[model samples]
Target chain A: MRPTPDPFTEALLARADDALVLGHRLSEWCGHAPTPEEDLALANLALDQIGLARALYAEVGAGSGRTEDELAYFRTDRDFRNCLLVEQPNGDFAHTIVRQFLYTAYADPFWRAAVGSADPALAAIAAKAELESAYHLRHASEWLIRLGDGTAESHARAQAALDALWPCTAELFEPEPKARLPDPVPLRAAWSATVDRVLARATLARPADGWAQTGGRRGRHTEAFGKMLAEMQSLARAHPGAVW
Target chain B: MSDDRRARAWAAAAAVVDPELPALTIADLGMLRDVTLAGDTIEVTITPSYTACPAMVVIGWEIEAALARAGLGPVRISTVLAPPWTSAWLSPEGRAKLAAAGIAPPPTAPADPGLFAVAAPACPRCASLATERISAFGATACKSLHRCLACREPFEAFKAHGDGSISNTASRDVLS
Candidate 1:
C-alpha cells in the first residue's frame, strides 16, 4: 500500500502542482506566441517550471511506491494544491504575462528562501529552481514594462489584466500551517516590494487590495482548472503505463 | 578488472562528444561524473545540464558503446540531479573550443539580481563586446541566442546552469 504523504510531502506536492499547472498553461503558447522569440521565451519558461515540477514530484513519490505520473495524471481535482493564481485562465497575452509575472515575482524569493530549507533534497531543488524563477521574473517584468508603457491599447490591457488577477495574489501569501518550512509571512513583504518595483517601472498602479479570494492551496480551484486538467491529463489517462 | 583497465575505460568514456556540441567531449562538458569498475561491471554516472536535454540518451548510448569498444562491457549509465550540472563546468579548454567554433559561453552568475545579467559575451568571430541578445532561449534548453553587433553574425551561448550559478564541477575549478 502507498504510504500516506506527510505534511512536508503535501507542501512539495502543492509547490509541484503550482509549477506543473502553470507550465502547462505557458506551453500552450508555443508556436502561438506573438513573435518567434516570445515563443521560445515562453516555452523556455514553461520548460523550467515543468522541470521543477518533475523534480518535486519525483521526490514526493520516491518512497511512497508511487510514480510521478500516477500523482500528476491519476489524481482528482480535489487532490491538487496549486495556488488559484496559477490555475487561473490564460485569457490573453496580457493576461498570461500578468499571471506569469505575479507568480514568478512571488516564486523567485520563495525559492531563494527555500534553498535554506531544513530538507536537503528540497533545498537542492530550490537552489536549482530559484535561478530559473529569477529568469522567469525578469522576462515577465520586461514584458510588463513594455506593454504597460507601450501604447494606450497595451497600457489598458496590462492594467486590466492586473486588476483581474489581483484578487488571486493574496492567496499566495497565505501560510501553509502544517508544512515544516519557513514562515511565508516574511516572504510576503519581499513579494510586494518586487511587485511594486516592477509595476512602478511599468507605469502601472498596484490594484487596491480588495476581497482576496483563497482555497487553491486546500484544493478548491476555479472552474477553468477542471478543463485544464481534463486536457492535460487526457493523453496520460488514455495510455496508462505507456512510456514516451 | 585491473586498475589500469578501469582507468582506460574511464578515459575512453570521457572521449565521447556531446551530441549537441560536437567540438567538446563529455569530460570537457563536465557531464562525466563518476565511473566505478568492479570486476567486469562498470557503473558510470552523469549529470545532465538541462532537465529535458534530449542529448542525454545519445550521450548515454555513446558512453556505453565507447566503454564496450574499450573492452569494458556490462556498463550501466545513471544520472544524478542533486548537484545539478552548470555551464560553468565547461573547462577553460572547452570554452576556447566553443569560441573557436563561434559559440559564446555564458557569463558568470551576477551578484545582484536587479537587471538581466546576461552580459554580451565578446563575439567569438570579431571579438566585440557589442552584442545583443536576440532571444533569451536558443535551440536547446541550456543555450540562448545572441547576435554580434560588430560582425552581424549570430551565435548561441551556453547558458549558465542551475540556480545562481552552482554547477557539478564549477565550484572547484575556475575557468580563465
Candidate 2:
C-alpha cells in the first residue's frame, strides 16, 4: 500500500507542481512572444519558476531518496497536487499575464512568510523563491496594468482574461490541514490588496467572487493539464536514464 | 597535511570564474559559501544568485574540475538557498571587473525606492545618470536591459534583488 504523505510533504509537492506546471506553460511562449524583449522576459520567468520547482522537489526528495527528476517525470496527473489555477492553458497573452499575476500575487506573500518556516531546507527554498517571486509579481502586474488600461481592444482582452481566471484563484487559498508551514488562507488578504490595487490602477473592474473551482490539491486537475503533462513527461519517459 | 589540502582546495575553488559572467569568479560573486574537509571528502557549499541561473550546473562542474586538477579528489559540491543571494553580495573587485566589461554592476546598497519608482543605473559606457530601463529582464534572469540617453547605448544592468526595491520601469518613462 502507498503510504499517505504527511502534511508537509503534501504541501511541498503541491507547491512544486504548481511551479513546474506554470513554468512549462510559460516556456511554451519562448519563441512565440509578441516582442523580442517580452520573449526574453517570459523565458526568464519560466527559468525562475522551473528553478524554484527543482529546489522544492529536491527538498521533498531528500528523505525519500527520490531524485527531483523521478518526482517530476514519474508522477501521474492523479498523483500531482498543484492547484487548478496553474494548469489552465495559455489562452492568450492577456490570459497568461492575468493567470501569472493572480498566482504571483499570492506566491510573493506566501514565499515571504515561508522564509520563517521552522524547516530550514524549506526556509532556504522560500528565501530564494521570495526574491524571484517578487520580480515575477512585478512583471505580471506591469503587463496586466498595461493591457487592462491600454487601447480598447487590449482592455477588453485583459478584462476577459481576469474574469475567466478569477474563479480558479479560490483554490489557491484552501487550507492545508496539519500543514507545518504558513497557511495560505491568511495570505489572501495581502493577495487581495495587491490584486485590488493593481486592478484599480489598470481601470479594470474586480470580477465578483462566485462558484470557485477546486480539487487540484487532491490530485484532480483540469482537462488541459493531462495533455501538458503528457508532453512534458514524454521525453523523460522515452529516454529513461538517457543523458547527453 | 590536511590543512595544506584544505587550503589548496579553497584556492582552486576560489579561482574558478563564473561561466556566464566571465569577468567575475565565483569567489568574486560570493557564490562560494563554504569549504570544509570532512574525512577524505572535501565538501564545498555555494549559493545561486537566482533560482534558475543556468550557470549553476556549469559552475559546479568547473569547481569539481578545478579541485581535481589541484590534486584534490573526492569533492562534493552542495548548493544552499537560505539568506538568499542578493546583488549586494557582489564583491568590490567583482563590481569593478563587471564595470570594466561594460556591464553596470548592481547598486551595492540600493536605497529602498518605493514600488513604481524607476531604476536609474549609471550607464556603463558614459557614466550617465540619464539612463532608463527598457525591459525588466535582459539576456539572463539576473539582468535588466537599459538604454542610456547620454550615450544612446543599450547595456545590461545586474538587477538589485531582495531589497524590496522595484528596478523595472517599463510602463512610464521616468526620465521626462
Candidate 3:
C-alpha cells in the first residue's frame, strides 16, 4: 500500500506536477504558435517550467527516492495533483493567455515567499525560478493589454476568452484554511487586483465572482484534463523507454 | 611553447569584436573560447550567444581571416554546442573596455547565497568595485544583467568565465 504524502512533500509535488504537465501543454505549441517570437517564447517558458518542475520533483521525491523522470513521466493521471486550470485545453491564443495569467499571477507570489522559506532547497529553486517567472508574467501581461485594448476583433476575442477562463482563476487561490503551505489569503486577494490591471488595460470586463468553482484541489477536474493527459502520456505509455 | 606567437595570434584574433557588442574584442568577452596550437593549424571554438544568432557564421569566418593575417594559416573555427558559452565569460578588463567606450559598465552582482554562485566582479573599464552586482543573467547568455550604483545605469555586464570548471558550466547549460 502507498503511504500518504507528507504536507511538505505534497506541496512540493503539487508544484512539480503543475509545472511538468503545464510544460507539456506549452510544448504542444512548439511549432504551432501563431508567431515566431511567440513560438520561441512558449518553448522557452516551457523549458523554464520543466526545469522548475525537476527541482521541486527532486525535493519532493527525496523522501520517496524517485527521480524527476519517474515522477513526471511514470505517474498515471490519477496520481497527478496539479490544479485543473493548468490542465485545461489550449483552445486558442486567448485561451493560452488566460491560462498563463491565472497561473503566473499566483505563482509569482508563491515563489517570492518560497524563496525565504524554512526549506533551503525550495528557497534556492525559488530564487532562480522567481526571476524566470517574472519574465513570464511580463510577457503574459503585455499580451493581455495588447489583445484587450487592440482592434475590434482582438478586443471581442480577448473578452470572450476572459469570460471562459474566469472560473479557472479561483482554483489557484484555493487552499484549506489550516493548510501548512504558505498563507492563501494574500495570494487569493492579490489575484483580483493583478487580473484587474491586465483586464483594465485590455479593455476587457472583469470576471464576476458570483459562483467560483473549486474541485481541482480535491482531485476533481474538468473534462479537459483527462484528454490532455491521454495525449501527453500516449507516447510514454506506448514505448516505456523509447527515447531518440 | 609559442607564448609570443600565441600572444600575437590571440591579439590578432582579439581584433574581431563581438558583432552584437562592438566595443569589446572577442577575446575580451572570452568569445575566442579557446586558442589551441595543434602543429601548424589553430582551432578556435566559438559559440554564438543566441542559438540562431546570425553573427555566428560571419564571426567564424572572421576568426579564420584574423588568424591568417597573424600568419597562422589554416585556422578553423568550430561552433561548439557542448561546453556552451555563457555571458559570464566576459572578463574584468572586458567590462572596463565597454565602459571606457562610454556605454555604462555592467552591474557587479553580489554573490549572495540566494542569488549567484560567485561574487567577484571587476569593471571591464575601471577595474573597481567588485561590491556591486545586479543580476545573474544579463541581456543574453554571454552577459550578466548588472547595474553599477557607482555608474547608475542598468548596464549589461560581461560575465567573466574563469575558474575553468566544466562541471559547473555544464550545470548552467542544463538549467538554461
Candidate 4:
C-alpha cells in the first residue's frame, strides 16, 4: 500500500499536477495552432507551465528519494491531484483559450499571495511563478476578448467554450483542509472581479455556478485524464533509466 | 585564501556567456546571483529570466565548465526564484549589446500598464519609436516580436518581466 502523503505534500502535488496536465494540453497545439505566432505563443506558455510543475515537483520530491521525473512519470491517474479543468482535452482553439483564461485568472492572484508564504522555498517558487502567471493571464485575457467580441461565429464559439468549462473552475478555489499554504478561498473575490472585467469587454456572459465538479483533489479524475497520463508517462515507462 | 578562491570562481562563472544571447555574459543579464567558497566546494546561485528559459540548462553547464577550466571544481549550482528576475536587471552594457545585436532593449522606466497596454518600443535599426508589436511572444519566452513602421524592420524586444515596478531593489543590490 502507498504511504499517505502529508497535507503539504498533497497540496503541493495538486499544484504540480495542474501545471503539468495543462502544460501538456497546451503543447498539443504546438504545430496545430491557427497561426504561426499563436503556435509559438502556445508552445512558450506550455514551457512556462511545465517549468512551474518541475519546480513544484522538485519541492515535493525533496527527502522522498524520488526525483521530479519519478514522481511525474510513475504516478497513476488516481494518484494525480490536478483539478478537472486542466485534464480536459483541447477541443478547439476557442476551448483552449477559454480554459487557459479561466485558470490564469485564478493562478495570477494565487501566485501573488503565495509569494508571501511562510515556507521560503514555496515563496521563492511563487515569486518566479507570479510573473509568468501574470503574462499568461494577460495573453489569455486578450485572446478571450478578441474571440468574444469578434465576428458572430467567433463570439458564439467563445461563449460555448466558456459555458462548457465554467463548472470545473469551482474546484480551483476549494479549501485545502490540511495545507498551511495560502488559502485559495480568499482569492475568489479578486478572480471574480478580473473575470467580470474581462468578460464585460469580451461581451461574454458568466455562466451560473451550479453543479461544481470536485474529486480531483481526492485523486479521482475524468476519463480524458487517464489517456493523457498514459501518453505523458509512456516514454519514461518505456525507458526506465534513459538519460539524454 | 578562500576569499581569493571565491573571487576567482565568481569571475569565472560571471564570464560565462548566455548560449541563447551570446552578446551578453551571464553577469550582464543579472543571472549570476552569488558565489561563495564553502570549504573546498564552490557554490553558485542564479535566477532564470523566465521560469522555463531553455537557456538555463546550457547556462548551468557553461558555468560548470568555466569554473572547471579555472580549477574551481566541486562547484554546486543552485537556482533561486525569490524576487524573481526582471528585464530591469539587465545591465546598461547588456542593453547596449542587445541593441547592437539588432534587438530592442526593454524600457528602463517602471510603468505598470494593463494587459492590452500598447508598448512603443524604439526600433533598433532606425531608432524609431513608431514600432508595433507583431506578437506578444517571440522566438523565446523572454522576448516579444515587433516591427518598425519607419525602418520596416522586424526586431525582438527583451520583454519587461515584472508586475508594475521596474526598479527591483533586490536586482539593484546584486547588479550594484
Candidate 5:
C-alpha cells in the first residue's frame, strides 16, 4: 500500500531524477575512454549507474504520473535537479576519476540513508543501489589513490583535476528540502562530513582558491547540459512516433 | 500434445550457440529467459549477458523464427536487465555442461556466505594450477581473462556480479 504520493516520496523521486540526468552525462563517455579496456570498463560502469538511475526514476515516474522516457527526455533543462559535478565533461582520464571519486563518496552515504527510508520502495531500491554505489566508491577511491600517488607527471595532472573538480563537489553536500518528501532521506547530514575525511586520505587538498559551483539543483544548468540533452535525446527526437 | 510440439520445436530452433561465448546455447545460458504462448501471439523474455552485448538482436531474430515456424501467430521478444543477470543464475548443470565441453566454469562462490572471496579465480586448464585474473572487464562485461601457470593456457572466467568488488588488475586479451 503506497501512500498517496507524499512530499517525502516526491523528494526521493526528485533525487532519482537528479541521478538519471547525471548518469546520462557519464554515459556519453562510453566509447571515448582512453584505452579500450578502460573504455569498456567505464562504459560498463556507466551502464550500471544508468541502470540504477533507471530503476529509481522509473519507480518515481510511476508515482508521478509520467513515463520514465517522458521524465528523462521531455523535460526542459530547468526542470532537472542533478548535482553539478556529474554534468562536467570527462576532461581527461584523471578528471573523470576525480569526478567519480567525489560523487560516489557523497552517494555512498546518500544510498545508505535511502536504504532505511520509511518508504519501503525507496528502501529496497536504496538497498540494491547501496551495493552498487559501494563498488563504485571502491573503484573511484582506488583510482583516486593511484592517480594521486602514481608518478610526478600523473600526480601533477591529478592535482590539477582535483582543483578543477573540487568546486562542484561542494554542492553535493548542500541540503535539500527533505521536509516535503513522503519518506525524506537523511542524506546530507551523514554524507557530507565523511567525504571531507576521505578527501584528506586521497592526499588531495580541497581547492582553497576557487569559488564553489552550484545551480543544477535549482535547474540552473551550465551551457554543457543543453548539449548533453540534445545528444542523449536525439534518437527519440529524430525517430518520433517510431516503434518496434 | 501441441504444447509438447511447440516446446520441442522451440528447443530445437533456439539451441543456437551464443555468438559471444559459443560454449553455451542461448537457452542454457539463460539469455533466452522466457517463452509464453497465446493462441495468436507468442511472447519471450531474453536476458543479455552484458547490457551492451551485441548478440541480443540476433537472439531476438532467432526467437521470432523459432516461434513463427512452430505456427505461433506472432513473436514478441522483450529484454530485462533487472535483478541483473549474474553468474549465480547459471544453473549447476550449465556449469557441468560448460566444464564437460572443456570451457572453464565461473569461479565457485564460497559456501560460507559470510567471507566473500574477492581476488581468487581458479584455472581450468591444469588441475594443480594457480589462476591469475588479468582484467575485470572481460571479452564482455560477463567474462574475465585468467591464466593458469600449471597448464600455461589462458582461459575465460565468468564474472559473478553478486560480488560487488572489482579488481584493478592487468588486462589480457582472451584469444578464444
Candidate 6:
C-alpha cells in the first residue's frame, strides 16, 4: 500500500508539477517566437524551469529511491499538483506574455520568501531559482509595457489577455490544506503591487477580480493539460529507462 | 607513485578552462568543488553556475580527459545541484582575468532582477560607470550584454548571484 505524502513532500510535489508543466508550455514556442532573440530567451526560461522541476522531483523522490524521470514521465495527469494558472492554454503572444507576467509576479516574491524555508534543500533551490525567476519577471514586465503601450491593436490585445488571465491569479495565493509551505497571502499582496505598478506604466487597466478558479491543487486540471502532458511524456514513456 | 599521480591529476584538471569564458580555468572560477582519491580511482565534483548551462557536458568530458592524461585508471565527474553555485565563488584572479578579457565581473552583490540599477556593472574596457544594459542575456547563459557610453564599446558582464552585494572589488573602480 502507498503511504500518504507528508505536508512537505506534498508541497514540494506541487512546486515541481507547476514548474514542469509551465516549462513544457513555454518550450512549445521554441522556434515559434516572433523574434529570433525571443525564441532563445523563451527557451532559456523553459530550460531554467525544467531544471528547477528536475531538482524538486529528485528531492521529492529521494526517500522512495525514485528518479526524476519516473516522477515526471510515469505519473498520470491525475497526480499533477500544479495550480490551474500554469496549465491554461497559451492563447496568443499577448496571452503568453500576460500569463508569464502574472506567474512571475507571484514566483519572484514566492521564491524570495522561500529562501528562508526551514528545509535547507528547499531554501537552496529557492536561492538559485529566485535569481532566475526575477529575470523572468523582468522579461515579461518589459513585454507587458511594450505591448500595452504600443500600437492600438497591441494595446487592445494586451488588455484582453489581462482580463482573461486575472481570474487564474487567485489560485496562486491559495494554499493546500495542512501544507507547511510558506504562506502565500503576503506573496499575493506583493504580486498585486508589482502587477499594478507595471500596468500603470503600460497604460493598461487592472482587471477586476472575478470568481477565482480552483481544483488544480486537488489534481483536477483543465482539458488542455491532459493533451500537453501526453506530448511531454510520450518520448520518455516510449523509451523506458533510456539513458544517453 | 600514487601521490605523484594525484598531483598530476589535480594540475591537469585545474588547467581546463571554462568553455564559454575561455579566459578562466575551472579552478580559477571556483567550479572545481572537490577531488577525491581512493587507491587508483578518483572522483571529482563540479557545480555548474546556471541550471541550464550547456558547458557542463564538455566540462565533464574535459575533466575525464585531463585525468586520463595523468595515467589515472578511471575517473568519475559528478555534478551536484544542491547548495547551488554563486558568483561569489569567482576568485580574485578570475575576476581580473575576466576584466582583462573585456568581460566585466559580476558585482559582489547577488543581482536582483528588481535591482539592476542598484549596482550596475562597470565597463571592463574603460572602467566607466556610464554603462547601460543592452540585454539581460548575452552570447552565453551566464553573461548579460552592456554598452559603455564613454568608450562606445559593448561588453558582457558576468551575472552576480547568491547575495546582492558588491564583492572585494567595489563599484568605486567604475565611479573613479
**Tens digit of lDDT per residue, candidate 3, span B1-176?**
57766677677777897777778777876667767777777767765443334466678878888888777767767655333344456678876777776444434442113112334355444545643655444434345554455545445554433222333311221111
Q: List runs of model 3 lying over 4 Å from the truth.
A: A176-180, A241-244, B1-176
Misplaced by over 4 Å in model 1 are: A177-180, B38-40, B108-113, B116-118, B162-176
Off by over 4 Å in 5: A1-21, A28-31, A116-128, A174-201, A206-212, B1-22, B25-86, B97-104, B110-118, B147-153, B163-176
Q: Residue B115, candidate 5: how far off, in angstroms? A: 16
On a 0 to 100 scale, what is the lDDT of residue B81 in model 2?
A: 77
lDDT of 1 by residue, A1-244 (tens): 6688888888889999999999999999999999999999888888888888888899899846678899889988888999999998888899999999999888887877777778888887876776667677888888898899889999999999999999999998886753456578877887888888889988998999989999998999889999999999999999999996
True contacts kept of 6: 0.25
lDDT of 5 by residue, A43-140 (tens): 66776666666666777777777666776777777877777888887788888888887787677766655554566666656655655565567667
Arrange candidates, best TM-score first: 4, 2, 1, 6, 5, 3
Assess the local accuracy of residue B78 in candidate 4 as a C-alpha lDDT between 0 and 100.
87
Over the stretch B1-176, how does candidate 6's per-residue lDDT look in tens digits? 76777777788888899998899999888888877787668888888787767788899999999877777758988887656677888889999999999999988766354422444688898899998877776677788777898999988899776553213311111101
Alpha-carbon lDDT of model 5: 0.64
lDDT of 4: 0.86
What clash pairs does model 1 have? none
Q: Candidate 6: give the clashing pairs.
A: B108-B165, B108-B166, B108-B167, B109-B164, B109-B165, B109-B166, B110-B163, B110-B164, B110-B165
Greater TM-score among 1 and 2 belongs to: 2
lDDT of 6 by residue, A137-230 (tens): 8788888989998999999999999998888888888765434356777778888888888998789999888798888888898899999999
DockQ, each predicted model: 0.35, 0.47, 0.05, 0.48, 0.13, 0.28
A best-first ranking of the candidates according to their DockQ comes to: 4, 2, 1, 6, 5, 3
**Global local distance difference test of model 2:** 0.86
Each candidate's TM vs. the true structure?
0.90, 0.94, 0.62, 0.94, 0.72, 0.84
Root-mean-square deviation per candidate: 3.9, 3.8, 12.2, 3.8, 7.0, 4.7
